[model samples]
Target: MRLNYILSDLGIGLKRNLTMTIAVVVTIWVSLSLFGAALLAREQVDLMKGNWYDKIQISIFLCTKDSGGRGCTGTEVTTEQKNRIKQVIEANPDTAPEGVFGESKKEAFEQFKKLYKDSPIVSTVTEDQMQESFRVKLKDPQRYQNLVSAVSGLPGVDTVQDLRQFLDPLFEALNKLQWGAVAAAGLLLVAALMQISNTIRLAAYARRREIGIMRLVGASNFYIQLPFLLEAILAALIGAAFACGTVWLGWYLFVKRQAEATFQVWQWVGPTEVFQATGVMVAVGLVLATIPTFVTTRKYLKV
Candidate 1:
């Protein structure tokens, strides 16, 4: 009997402020969707880092004839110069002691052919055209600077390239994008909270006569406020469901179907990530609805 009364009051409140209720739902949906996308993007960036960072290496290319390597002087790197470069790498504890692998021109040519097998450049390029280099795998990939500083400007060292340098900027850009989404979501969430607060206040004002009777009949604050709280929670729940659905559809269409198809080497965020984001939306919705409902009823729903 009590549950039915609460449900009836909730329906009346929702019907009385239908426009405001719709506004709250739409606002929460957009905010939660943006928030979910941000979380998923963060997951994707971490996944890429886990898969790619371990494989990153510093390539120290040696001087070659016709190569514009620093101090190349139109001469091939000598055996003595090569040995000196190898000693520098071996001496650095930050670099993997035994992870130094040298690729000769012939080896570089073979790798080029395997990589660009279908490209016309393979037919035009020759073994001599490829620059020999030392592949220095790091004990800790973050210590790339130490290895590069040690080998740069060495007699045979033409250039020291850290593959991570090329990738860091891309990751940084993605992080900025994630934060931007979060900021937008925060603003929208605040708007939704205000809208909820106003809607509850108006509903309480409209039912002052019944609330006065309840107060005279010895009704507790909890009983008096239950209907308004239910109304807010129900609207938030519906909004959160819509947000979750939008996020899932986007991930399926853009990330799983499009991105994973093209970039098989890297792992993308999956359904598990979407589920986690949905959990966040649920928590946010509850907090946003509960706080405002409790505060508004306490302040404005008195008989």
Candidate 2:
């Protein structure tokens, strides 16, 4: 009987403020969806960091016949200079213990041809035109600058190029995008909470007389507040449902498909990530609904 009364009151309250209820649901849906997207973005950035950082190498280019740097003479670097450079790289503790490899002119030429196979100049370049180099993989990819400082201007060294210089900007951009989503989600969540508080206040105000009668009849405060609490929880759950659907569709249908077809450099977030995001969204919804309803009822539904 008490459950029946609470359910009836919940229905009446929802009907009375249907517009506000819908607004709250939509607000929560958008906020939680953005939050989920932010989580996915962070996962993507971390995935790329793990995959690419290990692969990134600092290339120390040696002098070739055509090399024009101050460190490069007009002759090909000698075997002695090359050996000296390798010794310097291997002796440095900053470099990966097993990651240094010497690329001969022939090997460098072959790699260049493979990389630029479609380019018209691939036929024009020859093994003698390619400069021999040492590819040094650092223990920490970010410490390439230290290795570069150690190797640059050495007898055979023409230039030191770290791949991280190219990759860091992309990662930084994605991080900024992730933080932007977080900020937007935070603002929307605040709006959702405020809307929830207003809806509860209005519902309590509309049923004030009944609440007063219940109070006079010695009904417990919990019984009176139960309807409002149920209403908030129901709305938040519906919103969370929407958020879950949005995240699942985005990950399974759009992001997964597009990334599988086009972006292969890093692993994409999978169903596990989606499930984690859904858990967060649902938890957020419940907490957002319960806290505001509890506080509002305790303060305004005194009768």
What shift in Å separates residue 256 of candidate 1 from its native position after superposition? 2.0
Model 2 Cα lDDT, one tens digit per residue, 200-238: 988988778888889888888888889999999999999
Which candidate has the highest lDDT of all?
1
lDDT for residue 165 in candidate 2, whole number 0-100: 83
* Candidate 1: residue 224 Cα off by (Å): 1.3
Number of the top candidate by TM-score? 2
**Each candidate: what lDDT?**
0.89, 0.87
Deviation from native of the Cα of residue 73 in model 1, angstroms: 3.8
lDDT score, candidate 2, position 248? 93
lDDT of 1 by residue, 260-291 (tens): 56858888888888899899989999899999
RMSD of every candidate to native, in Å, equals 1.8, 1.7
- Deviation (Å) of 163 in candidate 1: 1.0
